[model samples]
Target: MSKIIQSFEAKELKKRPFIIKIADRLTSFFGSISFLILNLLFFVSWIIFNKFDQFPFPMLTMIVSLEAIFLTIIMLVSQQRQAHIATIREELDMQVNKYSEREITKVLNLLKIIAEKQDIKLDDKELDEMLNELELGYIERKLEEQLSEKQKLIIDLSPLNKS
Candidate 1:
């Protein structure tokens, strides 16, 4: 299962464009503690070495501002790429869950048959429900309706919403 997931992730990575790959690498590097320490050291060194008469070094500020802008853009691109991968992963998980549910249902049906063949009297109401085919769309709709109602209740109960 781990190998399968690794292979899936590798395939996803391979499908990304060259530029996105670079951005991902940059994002990893930039998000590291090492990058933070390096930036801190660089800023401290710049301030110490430069004998500027001005209080707020314009050049340093400009350089930092430009770096911030570029890094922000890089981070946004990385976030977009991550969001896409997350969406793909979510879809894959949903498929796996559906497949598992079907397999489990089949197993339960087989167990019920085996129990009857062995002359074992097992009366389970839940088993009857388990044997029935799931209407996924109806279940999803019901779940959404329940969640929406709960969300509305939560919003209404919030202190911010109170007069």
Candidate 2:
């Protein structure tokens, strides 16, 4: 794994509340094949050892249902934490990308100036475009517009939309 990813995970882990940390550990354990095997064994033993007169073992069913409810809550908590971390990571990535874009544009502009001073004629229209600073909001709006148009097209073509 990347050092950056490792560092980010470690930092996030440190910032988590004790309860969240426990939930994360439980989530990890619950997701494992070992947990699945243990659960299967427990269920089998419960069925074989318990001499219940009732056909469908109401006690076992209740225990399983209760476990499911608690497990679902724990999984949701873990997922929420993961989503928060993902959002932070995405924001960090966007900031880095924006900074890089600005730096690259500045460098390109400087190179163009240097080429002009050295009397080296470079005729690249794409380089000229790259030299200009990007309007990120404009780009974002244009992207949104394109996606909206595509979505509308998909909705119109759907069989559910037909009479």
Worst 10 residues of 1 by lDDT: 47-56
Best by TM-score: 2
lDDT on C-alpha atoms for all candidate structures: 0.90, 0.93
Compared with the true structure, what per-residue lDDT tens digits does model 1 show for residues 20-128? 9899999999999999999999999888887872558898899999999999999999899889888978888888889989999999999999999999998889889
Once model 2 is optimally superposed onto the true structure by TM-score, how far is the C-alpha of residue 27 displaced, in angstroms? 0.4
Residue 65 Cα positional deviation in candidate 2, in Å, after optimal superposition: 1.8
The TM-score between candidate 2 and the true structure equals 0.85
Tell me, what's the RMSD of every candidate?
2.7, 2.7
Error of 2 at 90 (Å): 0.9
> How do the predictions measure up, each by TM-score?
0.82, 0.85
